[model samples]
Target: MVTVKMLKPYYVKTEEKYIRIILAYQYFSIIMNKKVYQFIPVKSTEVRINRKTKKIENIDDVFAFQKGKEVLTISMSQLVSIPGFLEMLHRIAESYYLPEDTEAVSDQQRALDQLISELEYENVRRLIDKAIDNGDKEAFLELTNTLNDK
Candidate 1:
Protein backbone atom coordinates (compact mmCIF):
# COMPACT_ATOMS: atom_id res chain seq x y z
CA MET A 1 0.00 0.00 0.00
CA VAL A 2 1.24 3.47 -0.94
CA THR A 3 0.65 6.20 1.58
CA VAL A 4 0.15 9.66 0.14
CA LYS A 5 1.81 12.45 2.12
CA MET A 6 1.03 16.09 1.55
CA LEU A 7 4.06 18.31 1.29
CA LYS A 8 4.03 21.90 2.46
CA PRO A 9 4.14 24.12 -0.57
CA TYR A 10 6.68 26.85 -1.19
CA TYR A 11 5.27 30.32 -0.74
CA VAL A 12 6.61 32.99 -3.04
CA LYS A 13 5.90 36.50 -1.91
CA THR A 14 5.30 39.24 -4.43
CA GLU A 15 4.66 42.93 -4.20
CA GLU A 16 0.88 42.56 -4.22
CA LYS A 17 0.29 39.28 -2.33
CA TYR A 18 1.74 35.93 -1.36
CA ILE A 19 1.28 32.98 -3.71
CA ARG A 20 1.14 29.39 -2.53
CA ILE A 21 2.71 26.78 -4.81
CA ILE A 22 0.75 23.61 -4.00
CA LEU A 23 2.74 20.64 -5.21
CA ALA A 24 1.40 17.16 -4.75
CA TYR A 25 2.62 13.72 -5.74
CA GLN A 26 -0.29 13.35 -8.09
CA TYR A 27 0.71 16.50 -9.95
CA PHE A 28 3.85 14.96 -11.41
CA SER A 29 4.12 12.12 -13.89
CA ILE A 30 6.65 10.64 -16.27
CA ILE A 31 5.38 10.43 -19.83
CA MET A 32 7.80 8.81 -22.27
CA ASN A 33 11.08 10.73 -21.87
CA LYS A 34 9.53 13.84 -20.40
CA LYS A 35 8.58 14.77 -16.83
CA VAL A 36 5.50 16.93 -16.29
CA TYR A 37 4.54 19.19 -13.40
CA GLN A 38 1.16 20.78 -12.70
CA PHE A 39 0.93 24.02 -10.78
CA ILE A 40 -2.12 25.27 -8.82
CA PRO A 41 -2.60 28.74 -7.50
CA VAL A 42 -3.66 29.27 -3.91
CA LYS A 43 -4.54 32.35 -1.91
CA SER A 44 -4.64 33.20 1.74
CA THR A 45 -7.92 32.88 3.61
CA GLU A 46 -9.77 35.91 4.85
CA VAL A 47 -11.88 35.60 7.96
CA ARG A 48 -14.84 37.86 8.56
CA ILE A 49 -16.09 38.75 12.04
CA ASN A 50 -19.72 39.36 12.83
CA ARG A 51 -19.93 42.55 14.82
CA LYS A 52 -23.38 41.82 16.23
CA THR A 53 -22.42 38.39 17.59
CA LYS A 54 -18.84 39.43 18.33
CA LYS A 55 -17.62 36.25 16.67
CA ILE A 56 -15.85 35.17 13.52
CA GLU A 57 -18.32 33.71 11.09
CA ASN A 58 -16.74 32.79 7.79
CA ILE A 59 -13.36 32.17 6.29
CA ASP A 60 -12.41 31.58 2.67
CA ASP A 61 -9.41 29.92 1.04
CA VAL A 62 -7.97 32.57 -1.19
CA PHE A 63 -8.65 31.86 -4.85
CA ALA A 64 -10.11 28.46 -3.96
CA PHE A 65 -13.45 29.04 -5.61
CA GLN A 66 -12.95 31.97 -7.91
CA LYS A 67 -14.58 32.56 -11.27
CA GLY A 68 -11.60 31.79 -13.42
CA LYS A 69 -9.03 29.04 -13.37
CA GLU A 70 -5.27 29.73 -13.20
CA VAL A 71 -3.56 26.42 -13.63
CA LEU A 72 -0.12 25.97 -15.24
CA THR A 73 1.46 22.82 -16.61
CA ILE A 74 5.15 22.74 -17.45
CA SER A 75 7.55 20.05 -18.48
CA MET A 76 10.96 19.51 -16.89
CA SER A 77 12.77 20.93 -19.90
CA GLN A 78 10.50 23.95 -20.03
CA LEU A 79 10.78 24.62 -16.33
CA VAL A 80 14.56 24.55 -16.47
CA SER A 81 14.56 26.81 -19.48
CA ILE A 82 12.55 29.45 -17.66
CA PRO A 83 14.63 32.35 -16.37
CA GLY A 84 15.08 32.58 -12.56
CA PHE A 85 13.75 29.04 -12.11
CA LEU A 86 17.22 27.67 -11.43
CA GLU A 87 17.94 30.49 -9.02
CA MET A 88 14.67 29.82 -7.23
CA LEU A 89 15.53 26.13 -7.06
CA HIS A 90 18.93 26.93 -5.59
CA ARG A 91 17.38 29.21 -3.00
CA ILE A 92 14.85 26.55 -2.07
CA ALA A 93 17.54 23.92 -1.72
CA GLU A 94 19.65 26.16 0.48
CA SER A 95 16.70 26.95 2.73
CA TYR A 96 15.36 23.42 3.00
CA TYR A 97 18.52 21.30 3.14
CA LEU A 98 19.78 20.64 6.64
CA PRO A 99 23.41 21.01 7.65
CA GLU A 100 25.45 17.92 8.47
CA ASP A 101 25.70 16.97 12.12
CA THR A 102 29.02 17.74 13.79
CA GLU A 103 29.48 14.20 15.00
CA ALA A 104 28.72 12.73 11.58
CA VAL A 105 31.13 15.16 9.94
CA SER A 106 33.91 14.31 12.39
CA ASP A 107 33.33 10.60 11.79
CA GLN A 108 33.64 11.13 8.04
CA GLN A 109 36.88 13.04 8.53
CA ARG A 110 38.34 10.23 10.64
CA ALA A 111 37.40 7.66 8.00
CA LEU A 112 39.05 9.76 5.31
CA ASP A 113 42.23 10.09 7.36
CA GLN A 114 42.37 6.32 7.82
CA LEU A 115 41.93 5.73 4.09
CA ILE A 116 44.66 8.24 3.30
CA SER A 117 47.03 6.56 5.78
CA GLU A 118 46.38 3.15 4.18
CA LEU A 119 47.07 4.54 0.72
CA GLU A 120 50.32 6.13 1.91
CA TYR A 121 51.42 2.84 3.46
CA GLU A 122 50.69 1.01 0.19
CA ASN A 123 52.65 3.56 -1.80
CA VAL A 124 55.61 3.32 0.60
CA ARG A 125 55.59 -0.48 0.25
CA ARG A 126 55.70 -0.16 -3.55
CA LEU A 127 58.53 2.37 -3.31
CA ILE A 128 60.46 0.01 -1.03
CA ASP A 129 60.04 -2.83 -3.55
CA LYS A 130 61.26 -0.56 -6.34
CA ALA A 131 64.26 0.57 -4.30
CA ILE A 132 65.22 -3.07 -3.58
CA ASP A 133 64.82 -4.01 -7.25
CA ASN A 134 67.10 -1.18 -8.33
CA GLY A 135 69.72 -2.16 -5.69
CA ASP A 136 69.72 1.39 -4.29
CA LYS A 137 71.13 0.86 -0.79
CA GLU A 138 70.77 4.52 0.24
CA ALA A 139 67.14 4.72 -0.81
CA PHE A 140 66.34 1.38 0.89
CA LEU A 141 67.96 2.48 4.21
CA GLU A 142 66.24 5.89 4.12
CA LEU A 143 62.86 4.28 3.45
CA THR A 144 63.37 1.73 6.24
CA ASN A 145 64.37 4.50 8.65
CA THR A 146 61.28 6.52 7.74
CA LEU A 147 59.02 3.49 8.36
CA ASN A 148 60.72 2.85 11.75
CA ASP A 149 60.22 6.49 12.81
CA LYS A 150 56.54 6.24 11.94
Candidate 2:
Protein backbone atom coordinates (compact mmCIF):
# COMPACT_ATOMS: atom_id res chain seq x y z
CA MET A 1 0.00 0.00 0.00
CA VAL A 2 1.14 3.54 -0.76
CA THR A 3 0.49 6.46 1.53
CA VAL A 4 0.71 9.96 0.15
CA LYS A 5 1.44 12.99 2.31
CA MET A 6 0.96 16.57 1.28
CA LEU A 7 3.71 18.93 2.33
CA LYS A 8 3.50 22.70 2.75
CA PRO A 9 1.55 24.63 0.17
CA TYR A 10 2.24 28.10 -1.18
CA TYR A 11 0.18 30.70 -2.93
CA VAL A 12 0.85 33.19 -5.73
CA LYS A 13 -1.50 35.96 -6.75
CA THR A 14 -1.66 37.54 -10.17
CA GLU A 15 -3.78 40.36 -11.43
CA GLU A 16 -7.01 38.35 -11.75
CA LYS A 17 -6.33 34.98 -10.13
CA TYR A 18 -4.68 33.18 -7.30
CA ILE A 19 -2.83 29.87 -7.53
CA ARG A 20 -2.16 27.40 -4.75
CA ILE A 21 0.98 25.36 -5.21
CA ILE A 22 1.32 22.17 -3.21
CA LEU A 23 4.26 19.85 -2.77
CA ALA A 24 3.32 16.23 -2.17
CA TYR A 25 5.25 13.30 -0.85
CA GLN A 26 4.58 9.65 -1.38
CA TYR A 27 5.42 6.82 0.99
CA PHE A 28 5.54 3.37 -0.56
CA SER A 29 6.22 -0.07 0.84
CA ILE A 30 8.22 -2.64 -1.01
CA ILE A 31 7.73 -6.40 -0.92
CA MET A 32 10.25 -6.57 1.92
CA ASN A 33 8.14 -4.03 3.91
CA LYS A 34 10.69 -1.32 3.41
CA LYS A 35 9.08 2.11 3.29
CA VAL A 36 10.37 4.87 1.08
CA TYR A 37 9.32 8.46 0.69
CA GLN A 38 9.77 10.73 -2.28
CA PHE A 39 9.34 14.47 -2.64
CA ILE A 40 7.39 16.10 -5.44
CA PRO A 41 7.64 19.73 -6.56
CA VAL A 42 5.44 22.45 -7.99
CA LYS A 43 2.07 20.72 -8.07
CA SER A 44 -0.22 23.69 -8.48
CA THR A 45 -3.96 24.25 -8.26
CA GLU A 46 -5.97 27.36 -9.00
CA VAL A 47 -8.18 29.30 -6.58
CA ARG A 48 -11.13 31.32 -7.73
CA ILE A 49 -12.78 34.38 -6.24
CA ASN A 50 -16.44 35.15 -6.65
CA ARG A 51 -16.97 38.80 -7.58
CA LYS A 52 -20.66 39.10 -6.85
CA THR A 53 -20.56 37.23 -3.58
CA LYS A 54 -17.03 38.36 -2.64
CA LYS A 55 -16.18 34.81 -1.69
CA ILE A 56 -12.89 32.96 -2.02
CA GLU A 57 -12.70 29.25 -2.73
CA ASN A 58 -9.97 26.73 -3.30
CA ILE A 59 -10.24 24.67 -6.44
CA ASP A 60 -8.93 21.21 -7.11
CA ASP A 61 -10.09 18.83 -9.81
CA VAL A 62 -13.67 19.73 -8.95
CA PHE A 63 -15.86 22.78 -8.49
CA ALA A 64 -15.16 25.21 -5.70
CA PHE A 65 -17.57 25.60 -2.79
CA GLN A 66 -18.55 29.07 -1.66
CA LYS A 67 -20.82 29.64 1.32
CA GLY A 68 -22.36 26.15 0.96
CA LYS A 69 -23.06 26.69 -2.70
CA GLU A 70 -21.10 25.67 -5.76
CA VAL A 71 -19.73 28.90 -7.16
CA LEU A 72 -17.58 28.05 -10.17
CA THR A 73 -15.70 25.14 -11.68
CA ILE A 74 -12.59 25.15 -13.80
CA SER A 75 -11.40 22.39 -16.04
CA MET A 76 -7.89 21.99 -17.41
CA SER A 77 -9.02 23.47 -20.71
CA GLN A 78 -10.67 26.44 -19.03
CA LEU A 79 -7.66 27.08 -16.85
CA VAL A 80 -5.46 27.34 -19.94
CA SER A 81 -7.73 29.97 -21.46
CA ILE A 82 -6.16 32.80 -19.47
CA PRO A 83 -3.82 34.97 -21.49
CA GLY A 84 -0.10 34.43 -20.83
CA PHE A 85 -0.87 31.71 -18.28
CA LEU A 86 1.18 29.11 -20.13
CA GLU A 87 3.98 31.62 -20.57
CA MET A 88 3.97 32.36 -16.87
CA LEU A 89 4.13 28.65 -16.13
CA HIS A 90 6.98 28.24 -18.57
CA ARG A 91 8.90 31.04 -16.89
CA ILE A 92 8.31 29.49 -13.48
CA ALA A 93 9.54 26.09 -14.64
CA GLU A 94 12.56 27.62 -16.31
CA SER A 95 13.46 29.62 -13.22
CA TYR A 96 13.72 26.38 -11.26
CA TYR A 97 15.46 24.12 -13.81
CA LEU A 98 17.13 26.26 -16.45
CA PRO A 99 20.52 27.91 -16.32
CA GLU A 100 20.98 31.42 -14.93
CA ASP A 101 20.80 34.34 -17.42
CA THR A 102 19.73 32.11 -20.27
CA GLU A 103 18.00 35.05 -21.93
CA ALA A 104 19.58 35.96 -25.27
CA VAL A 105 21.11 39.40 -24.82
CA SER A 106 23.10 38.92 -28.01
CA ASP A 107 19.91 38.90 -30.05
CA GLN A 108 18.93 42.25 -28.57
CA GLN A 109 22.40 43.61 -29.22
CA ARG A 110 22.23 42.47 -32.82
CA ALA A 111 18.90 44.17 -33.30
CA LEU A 112 20.20 47.43 -31.83
CA ASP A 113 23.29 47.28 -33.95
CA GLN A 114 21.21 46.67 -37.04
CA LEU A 115 19.08 49.71 -36.27
CA ILE A 116 22.14 51.88 -35.68
CA SER A 117 23.73 50.68 -38.90
CA GLU A 118 20.55 51.54 -40.81
CA LEU A 119 20.49 55.04 -39.34
CA GLU A 120 24.17 55.57 -40.09
CA TYR A 121 23.64 54.41 -43.66
CA GLU A 122 20.80 56.87 -44.13
CA ASN A 123 22.78 59.71 -42.59
CA VAL A 124 25.81 58.99 -44.80
CA ARG A 125 23.61 58.83 -47.90
CA ARG A 126 22.09 62.21 -47.07
CA LEU A 127 25.50 63.72 -46.40
CA ILE A 128 26.87 62.39 -49.69
CA ASP A 129 23.82 63.67 -51.58
CA LYS A 130 24.16 67.08 -49.99
CA ALA A 131 27.86 67.25 -50.90
CA ILE A 132 27.10 66.37 -54.53
CA ASP A 133 24.24 68.90 -54.76
CA ASN A 134 26.36 71.69 -53.25
CA GLY A 135 29.15 71.03 -55.78
CA ASP A 136 31.53 70.07 -52.98
CA LYS A 137 33.72 67.78 -55.12
CA GLU A 138 36.27 67.12 -52.41
CA ALA A 139 33.64 66.04 -49.82
CA PHE A 140 31.74 63.90 -52.35
CA LEU A 141 34.92 62.24 -53.60
CA GLU A 142 36.12 61.68 -50.06
CA LEU A 143 32.86 60.04 -49.06
CA THR A 144 32.76 57.79 -52.15
CA ASN A 145 36.39 56.84 -51.59
CA THR A 146 35.64 55.90 -47.98
CA LEU A 147 32.69 53.76 -49.07
CA ASN A 148 34.77 52.03 -51.76
CA ASP A 149 37.46 51.19 -49.20
CA LYS A 150 34.78 49.41 -47.11
Candidate 3:
Protein backbone atom coordinates (compact mmCIF):
# COMPACT_ATOMS: atom_id res chain seq x y z
CA MET A 1 0.00 0.00 0.00
CA VAL A 2 1.24 3.53 -0.87
CA THR A 3 1.47 5.74 2.23
CA VAL A 4 2.12 9.45 2.61
CA LYS A 5 5.27 9.90 4.69
CA MET A 6 5.06 13.10 6.77
CA LEU A 7 7.35 15.85 5.47
CA LYS A 8 7.65 19.60 5.96
CA PRO A 9 4.92 22.22 5.53
CA TYR A 10 4.70 23.88 2.10
CA TYR A 11 3.65 27.50 1.96
CA VAL A 12 1.94 29.60 -0.73
CA LYS A 13 1.51 33.34 -0.37
CA THR A 14 -1.11 35.34 -2.29
CA GLU A 15 -2.19 38.97 -2.09
CA GLU A 16 -4.90 38.26 0.49
CA LYS A 17 -3.62 35.23 2.39
CA TYR A 18 -0.74 32.85 3.09
CA ILE A 19 -1.50 29.14 2.69
CA ARG A 20 0.56 26.30 4.12
CA ILE A 21 0.27 22.82 2.64
CA ILE A 22 1.74 19.91 4.56
CA LEU A 23 3.74 17.78 2.18
CA ALA A 24 3.94 14.07 3.05
CA TYR A 25 5.86 12.65 0.11
CA GLN A 26 9.57 11.86 0.34
CA TYR A 27 9.93 12.12 -3.47
CA PHE A 28 7.92 14.02 -6.04
CA SER A 29 7.90 15.45 -9.54
CA ILE A 30 6.68 18.95 -10.37
CA ILE A 31 4.80 18.81 -13.65
CA MET A 32 4.60 22.07 -15.58
CA ASN A 33 2.98 23.14 -18.83
CA LYS A 34 4.58 25.46 -21.40
CA LYS A 35 1.47 27.66 -21.60
CA VAL A 36 1.15 28.08 -17.83
CA TYR A 37 4.63 28.95 -16.56
CA GLN A 38 5.71 30.73 -19.81
CA PHE A 39 9.41 30.81 -20.97
CA ILE A 40 10.88 28.81 -18.06
CA PRO A 41 12.26 25.60 -19.59
CA VAL A 42 11.66 23.02 -16.85
CA LYS A 43 9.12 20.37 -17.75
CA SER A 44 9.55 18.54 -14.41
CA THR A 45 11.89 18.68 -11.44
CA GLU A 46 12.96 15.49 -9.64
CA VAL A 47 13.17 16.25 -5.95
CA ARG A 48 15.14 14.30 -3.33
CA ILE A 49 13.17 14.54 -0.07
CA ASN A 50 15.18 14.73 3.13
CA ARG A 51 13.70 12.95 6.14
CA LYS A 52 15.60 14.95 8.80
CA THR A 53 13.05 16.33 11.27
CA LYS A 54 15.04 17.94 14.12
CA LYS A 55 15.95 21.38 12.73
CA ILE A 56 14.62 24.13 10.49
CA GLU A 57 15.73 23.37 6.91
CA ASN A 58 16.30 25.80 4.10
CA ILE A 59 13.44 25.80 1.57
CA ASP A 60 15.79 25.61 -1.40
CA ASP A 61 17.61 22.38 -0.46
CA VAL A 62 14.51 20.30 0.16
CA PHE A 63 13.16 21.57 -3.19
CA ALA A 64 14.59 20.53 -6.58
CA PHE A 65 17.18 23.07 -7.73
CA GLN A 66 20.59 24.20 -6.48
CA LYS A 67 21.01 27.72 -7.98
CA GLY A 68 18.99 28.60 -11.08
CA LYS A 69 15.20 29.01 -11.47
CA GLU A 70 13.56 26.97 -8.71
CA VAL A 71 10.78 24.58 -9.48
CA LEU A 72 7.51 25.22 -7.67
CA THR A 73 6.89 21.93 -5.87
CA ILE A 74 3.35 20.73 -5.57
CA SER A 75 3.23 17.48 -3.59
CA MET A 76 2.27 14.49 -5.67
CA SER A 77 0.28 13.25 -2.69
CA GLN A 78 -1.76 16.48 -2.82
CA LEU A 79 -2.64 15.62 -6.41
CA VAL A 80 -4.95 12.72 -7.18
CA SER A 81 -3.08 9.96 -8.94
CA ILE A 82 -3.50 7.83 -12.11
CA PRO A 83 -6.84 8.54 -13.88
CA GLY A 84 -7.12 11.97 -12.25
CA PHE A 85 -3.73 13.09 -13.57
CA LEU A 86 -4.69 11.89 -17.03
CA GLU A 87 -8.02 13.75 -16.79
CA MET A 88 -6.29 16.97 -15.70
CA LEU A 89 -3.84 16.73 -18.60
CA HIS A 90 -6.77 16.20 -20.96
CA ARG A 91 -8.53 19.31 -19.61
CA ILE A 92 -5.39 21.41 -20.04
CA ALA A 93 -5.01 20.16 -23.58
CA GLU A 94 -8.62 21.09 -24.43
CA SER A 95 -8.36 24.60 -22.92
CA TYR A 96 -9.41 27.68 -24.96
CA TYR A 97 -6.01 29.46 -24.91
CA LEU A 98 -4.27 26.59 -26.76
CA PRO A 99 -3.68 28.73 -29.95
CA GLU A 100 -6.38 27.08 -32.10
CA ASP A 101 -9.25 29.19 -30.70
CA THR A 102 -7.42 32.51 -31.35
CA GLU A 103 -7.75 32.01 -35.11
CA ALA A 104 -11.54 31.59 -34.88
CA VAL A 105 -12.14 35.35 -34.37
CA SER A 106 -13.20 36.87 -37.69
CA ASP A 107 -10.78 39.33 -39.37
CA GLN A 108 -13.55 41.66 -40.61
CA GLN A 109 -14.89 42.41 -37.07
CA ARG A 110 -11.35 42.97 -35.78
CA ALA A 111 -10.49 45.39 -38.63
CA LEU A 112 -13.75 47.36 -38.26
CA ASP A 113 -13.25 47.85 -34.48
CA GLN A 114 -9.58 48.75 -35.07
CA LEU A 115 -10.63 51.38 -37.65
CA ILE A 116 -13.37 52.70 -35.32
CA SER A 117 -10.95 53.11 -32.39
CA GLU A 118 -8.23 54.74 -34.54
CA LEU A 119 -10.54 57.47 -35.94
CA GLU A 120 -9.93 60.79 -34.11
CA TYR A 121 -12.90 63.05 -34.89
CA GLU A 122 -16.52 62.51 -33.78
CA ASN A 123 -16.39 58.67 -33.76
CA VAL A 124 -19.52 58.42 -31.69
CA ARG A 125 -21.26 60.66 -34.24
CA ARG A 126 -20.35 58.10 -36.92
CA LEU A 127 -21.74 55.34 -34.68
CA ILE A 128 -24.90 57.36 -34.09
CA ASP A 129 -25.27 57.86 -37.82
CA LYS A 130 -24.93 54.10 -38.39
CA ALA A 131 -27.32 53.33 -35.52
CA ILE A 132 -29.89 55.81 -36.84
CA ASP A 133 -29.60 54.31 -40.31
CA ASN A 134 -30.11 50.79 -38.92
CA GLY A 135 -32.76 51.90 -36.39
CA ASP A 136 -30.81 50.02 -33.62
CA LYS A 137 -32.54 50.89 -30.33
CA GLU A 138 -29.93 49.16 -28.11
CA ALA A 139 -27.07 51.06 -29.78
CA PHE A 140 -29.03 54.35 -29.38
CA LEU A 141 -29.61 53.66 -25.64
CA GLU A 142 -25.93 52.77 -25.14
CA LEU A 143 -24.90 55.97 -26.95
CA THR A 144 -27.22 58.04 -24.76
CA ASN A 145 -25.86 56.35 -21.61
CA THR A 146 -22.25 56.98 -22.68
CA LEU A 147 -23.06 60.62 -23.43
CA ASN A 148 -24.66 60.94 -19.98
CA ASP A 149 -21.64 59.35 -18.30
CA LYS A 150 -19.25 61.88 -19.86
Q: Pick the candidate with the highest TM-score.
A: 1
Per-model TM-score, in order, reads 0.37, 0.32, 0.20
Query: What TM value does model 1 have?
Result: 0.37
Select the stronger candidate by TM-score from 1 and 2: 1
TM-score result, candidate 2: 0.32
Question: Cα lDDT for residue 134, model 2?
Answer: 100
lDDT of 2 by residue, 1-150 (tens): 322222232443433333333323331111112333333222324434332232334334432212223233334344444455445444433323323233577788789999998887777778899998999999999988766664
lDDT of 1 by residue, 1-150 (tens): 111122233442222122223343333222222323233434332222332232223322322212225333333344444455445444433433333566889999999999998898888888889999999999999988877776
Which of the two, 1 or 3, has more TM-score?
A: 1
Q: Residues 57-81, candidate 3, lDDT per residue (tens digit)?
A: 2234323211134445333343334
Residue 149 error for model 3, in Å?
1.5
The stretch of ten residues in a row with the least summed lDDT in candidate 3 is: 11-20
